[model samples]
Target: MGLSPSKRVDAALRRAPAFAAACDDAFDRCLADAQGAFRGVRLYQLADAAARLHASLRASVPLVRRWVPSPPPRARVDAALRAAGLEGEAELSRAQLGEFAAELFREAVLAGAAGIVGVGVAARAAPAVVGRVVAVYAAGAAAALYLSLG
Candidate 1:
């Protein structure tokens, strides 16, 4: 048995502060690494993408509770990057951008799961609950990108 849905949400919320801190640290490190290895618009684009990923995960909790079905994961991520103006930007190749997007998304979702675990939420429910959280985060990220850059 596991915590109820609402209890899981509450546990996640309690865990969020720590999770958010970890996300910030990871994103900053990624940005710093990019600075040394990238420059100019490429660098800026990576940073922007990272920011969107971080912000999207941070904002996902509420939206997850209101879950709606969306396109498959690849499509969603692609749409989000495109909506965020990552396509044909010449700042980064499609492959590069795709790799970065996938990496960042994975990191975000893992962070969510870690947060749930950190808060001592029921282990059994973590995957399903975390998936819902991450799905909504992706949607919000896509929407934010579209509104801001589409």
Candidate 2:
């Protein structure tokens, strides 16, 4: 095997600090879920963790945005949030957020810097959603993609 999931996470930590910090915080926030994502190395478990973490982040969006300097434009934020497929205030399941995040990352890449920067706020405001398990998810598969590449 090239590397275990834990090893991959260590590599990611070395590769990105903000990402790593978000991972670290996520670990502290939800130990079982974090373990599920980091140690289990199962996509299902990882996806579960991503959903919970996203929920945490979703719940705390307003608080996190306050800390971010000049948050992304409302239009872009709304557009991205819309991708989550929420009907009013209905909560999303892990699968739903994961699907949305995966697609969002790909679309963001095509959108260029603006799209990338739009999602960057998640990094600075990662916590309060608890260790940001998504970062620790691989530092989180879909959550990591959502935060890093969203």
Angstrom error at residue 66, model 1: 9.6
lDDT of 1: 0.46
Model 1 stretches with alpha carbons more than 4 Å out: 1-41, 53-91, 120-150
Highest TM-score model number: 1
lDDT of 1 at 81: 52
State each model's CA lDDT, in order. Answer: 0.46, 0.38
Task: Write candidate 2's Cα lDDT for 27-145 as tens digits.
Answer: 44444645554432232333434344334433443222222223233343345456555424343344444343333322332343223333545566545333444334323343433
The TM-scores, one per candidate, come to 0.28, 0.27
Global local distance difference test of model 2: 0.38
Task: Using lDDT, give the best candidate's number.
Answer: 1
lDDT for residue 58 in candidate 2, whole number 0-100: 36
TM-score for predicted model 1 compared with the true structure = 0.28
Expressed as tens digits, the lDDT of each residue in 1-150 for candidate 1 is 855333444345435554354444445555565675643235444555555544554455442222312212544445545655665664554345444444444434433433434333445556778677657765665454333321
Clashes of each: 0, 7
